[model samples]
Target: MNNNKSISVQNLTKKFGNFTAVNAISFEVEKGEIFGFLGANGAGKTTAMKMLIGISKPTSGEAKVAGFDVYKDTEKIKKNIGYMSQKFALYDDLTVRENARFYGGIYGLSKKQIKKKTNEFITELGIADIADNLVGSLPLGWKQKLAFSVSLIHEPKVVFLDEPTGGVDPITRRQFWEMIYKQADNGTTIFVTTHYMDEAEYCDRVSIMVEGKIEALDTPENLRKQYGVDSMNAVFLKLARG
Candidate 1:
């Protein structure tokens, strides 16, 4: 997996005032891999992800995302990655195509490229009828899907999803994961964070954070076996008890 390493974290740490949000975590994400980042509330998963994505600088240690150093090359790293936060980062007042244009422009996508990709995304998502409709008029599921597509408008090498399926129904979550799988199959590295243990099984490999440390990391099968548990929930229960 050496050549496949798309993101590397080494003893990364982040602090706020006197509290340590992310405490010395290290890991690597391979290219074309669906890497699951799992954690409970206040476990520092989001903090670690922020540092990796270059929005939050590490307090100590080092990290490289898409081959750019987190400390000094944030701009370069920004160009190589796309991000979708749980809060749905989109313009509610803008139409679907207009929203796409706004995000595409921010990522420096050429006008021609944005037009081409917007058409393709609308056709694939079967949302051409509402292409000109304001994003606020769309359903939650449709907005989530469109936000994902817009994030990738620049064709970034890596995409980070922070609880991308947070408020969706079970069916929509399933559908969202399917889209993530398609992108992974197309050679895009997917670094996702989720609280759903069931969704963790769908990842190529998963890492569980407990109090800002990677307490468990492996394929679903191996993790279950190692914990002597039949399901990820049981494994998580055991870990949480410790």
Candidate 2:
């Protein structure tokens, strides 16, 4: 296991009954790198992420996340990682401050730490005025940003984002990416799954899964050149069609 790598997997596989969701796939994510996990629906992206995040157990092969073995150290993995699903997992009824406190408690943060962090986060995001408002009343983009902040309350080593920018306007998406870039700059490895090809361009490296297998893995520029395409959309179309 390389100490500098945040995630390492070799021939990692998962099956449901007789169907193999993720075939023998191998990959490594370096510390602070923005790794893009791309694939069409049912292409095994979700299944693979579940295994890496320590929620879904693999049927065979070896894998490690945040330097902990997936088979034995799932609890540790969960503690050292943050996850923001596509659904924007925030309590709609809770106020911004309450949500922060809720997640902080779950991550075993001290009350003083939670208060300090919450103040910093709200001030940083410029949401201090609405800290007491119900989350359901905030705009979608604000909620998305808030959820992301909550995910980082414990300062996890890695953050997994599942289509995090879905349904947001172009400006909101760009703003979200800026936040992602800031996190990566601070040494948090970001492993994200997305269907948006345009977003793929922002990744340091991307792996495209086709039919439960990683058919292509490389930087966006290299992939475009290798496939003789002008954009990631075309690159994905060319590979997914085959």
Candidate 3:
């Protein structure tokens, strides 16, 4: 394992019965890089992410995350990664402070650390006045931002964000990416999956999946230039259609 690589996979495969969910795929994500993982529905992107996050085991081949082998060190991998689903996982019934405390406890953070994070969220996010308000009462954009901050409470080495901005408005999406950029700048490896082609441009590097395999992996500029397209949307449409 290379010390500089946050995620490393080679010939990684996941199968169920006779069907292969994720075909043999290989790639590496450098530390502190924002890597965009894209794919259409049923493209096996989620399956591949599951293996990397230690949610599910791979059928064959090798994979490593945060310097731990995926096959044997699943527990260790989980401890080093934070995750946020596209659907958003914050507890609607819990207030901002309560939710932070809840997740902080789950991560084994001490009371002092949780209090510090809650105060940071209240101050940094400028939501101090509403810190005690229920999360469900907040706007979708607000919840999205809060959920992101919660995921980093443990300060994991890598974060797996699955389509985090799925239904957010443009302004919210931009704000969300700013937070992402800040985290990346702090040396956090970001592994994000998004359907919005424009979001692809924000990534340092991107990998597009098709039929359970990574069909294209490169910077957005190189991808556009390679496909002779003007936008990532066009690049995706061409690849997804073909």
Candidate 4:
């Protein structure tokens, strides 16, 4: 009940007609925590995330994000959270500067604030020479980084990332994670869904979903040790198979 927790859910469920997409589930994430959400394809992780982010109403549950109730304060939840998806990072046709300006404005930044942040982004991302160039022209790695920075334009209390590093190289993913660690260090709660086992190990804690239910929730080291496995991947496989 304390507001210090970034996310809290109780018996959250979502159903499409007679079929339940996300079974009743509950969890809590502390402020500044990196919570890894893991599941196989169609395991209901996305469905549950939708409810937590206030995108989809839960069938029956009580949930809160950033201290705002998901049912009564859906709009408030949206304002306090940043979201980034691997599928669509940014508009390719828009220039890097334009994309930043657009997202900053969408977040309700004043013209002056947008200008200042846009210039900061240019300098920080080292895109000063190509600030006017189309975002499509940048490398995939740069685009992902830019997308991430833009998501934080409003300094959200929490961020939700869906497979943020799908096709990037190991070096780029490492760099992206460094950025993640920095944000968490600054007291931003990060709720991320990733298929990469190595990334899962970086989380303060991880919840693994199976068949619309949470099969395991614990630290990576604990999960491995509890299951008598050497790696998170092995723990996942052992749980998923059972």
Candidate 5:
């Protein structure tokens, strides 16, 4: 195992009955690297992520996430990773502080640690005034940012984001990416999936999945040059269309 590699996979595959959601695919994600996993609907990105996250087992092949085997050390992997999905995973009725405490507890933090971290996060996010407010009352961008923060309460080695910027405005998306960059700078590997081509450009390296196979994996600049395109949108369109 390479200490610098946060994620490593070889011939990883997942199937449902006779349907193969993720074909034999192999890739590696370096520590602190922002890796964009891209594909259109039904492109198997979710399935592969599930395998890496240890929620779904692969049909064959080997994978290691945060230095733990996906099949054998799922519990350890879970402890070392955070996940933010498309939907806001916080409880709507819970106050911002409450939600933070809840997630912190799930990560097995002590009450003292939870309280301390929650206070720091609220202050850092400039939500100290509204820490007692219900999460549902917050703006979409605030909620998204808060959700991301909560996911990191345990200081996980890696964070997986699935279409995290789906419905927000451009400014919100930019702000969210800033948070991602900060996390990566702090040594947290970011594995993200997004439909927005612009978001793909922010990654250190991106992998484009088509028909359950990775067709391209490289830096955004390199991918653009390889595909003879000016933008990631164009590159994605060309690959996805075929």
Candidate 6:
């Protein structure tokens, strides 16, 4: 693993029985960069992310995240990275504070550390009123934000978000992006997968997956220029149609 790269994948492939989900895709994410992974449904984005994070082993090729081999050092990789899914996988039965404690504990945080971090998050998010409330009872936006905080509670070096803003309103999405920016500013590399074209523009660089392959990878500005299109939506349309 290179000292500079936070996440690296080389010819990564995944297969489900007869179908190839991710076919020989390769990419790299640098330290502290917000890298977007964008693709339509069944476009192999999730498959690739699973391989990088080490939960789903690649059928072929190699990957390293946070300087550890994906296949051999999955546990170590898990410790060095945080993952948030599209479903916001926190306990609905648990209160805001309780959920934070649960995740922090699993990540090997000490009791005192969990308490300190929980308090800091509650204050920083200005959600003290809901700290004791069940996560299921809170608004969707609040729950989404809380899920993000829980994922980062242990201060992992890299964070992977799978459509973290799936159903939230535009206003909530903006707030979520702000939090993402803050984490990146603090030296946390963000790897995100989203279907929203506008959200792709926020990434430092984006990779578009289609048919289990990375069809395009570039900054939003450069992609538009290369494709002679006005927006990422148009660029995707052109590529998907071809």
TM-score of 3: 0.98
- Count: clashes, candidate 5: 0
- Runs of candidate 2 with Cα error greater than 4 angstroms are none
- Scored by CA lDDT, what does every candidate get? 0.91, 0.96, 0.94, 0.91, 0.95, 0.93
In candidate 4, what are the lDDT values of residues 1-242, reduced to their tens digit?
99779999898999999989899899999999999999988999899998988889999988999999999999899999999986867899999878888988888999888888788767876778988889999899988988998898888999999999999999999999998999999999999999999999999999999988999999999999999999999988987888
Q: Compose the digit string of candidate 6's lDDT tens values, residues 94-195.
A: 999899999999999999999999999899999888899999998899989999999999999999999999999999999999999999999999999998
60-112 in candidate 2: lDDT tens per residue?
A: 99999999999999999999999999998989999999999999999999999
CA deviation > 4 Å runs, candidate 6: none
lDDT of 1 by residue, 44-132 (tens): 99899988888888999988888889999999999999999999888999999999999999888899999999999999999889999
Tens-digit per-residue lDDT, 184-236, candidate 5? 99999999999999999999999999989999999999999999999999999
Candidate 1: regions farther than 4 A off: none
Clashes of each: 0, 0, 0, 0, 0, 0
Output candidate 5 Cα RMSD.
Answer: 0.7
Model 5 residue runs over 4 Å out of place are none
Please identify which of the two predictions, 4 or 6, would achieve the higher TM-score against the true structure: 6
What is the lDDT, from 0 to 100, of the residue 71 in candidate 1? 97
Residue 19 in candidate 4, Cα distance off native in Å: 1.5
Candidate achieving higher lDDT, 2 or 4: 2
Evaluate residue 56 in candidate 3 and report its C-alpha lDDT on the 0 to 100 scale.
93
Candidate 5 lDDT score at position 89: 89
Winner on lDDT (4 vs 5) = 5
Q: Could you tell me which residue pairs clash in candidate 4? A: none
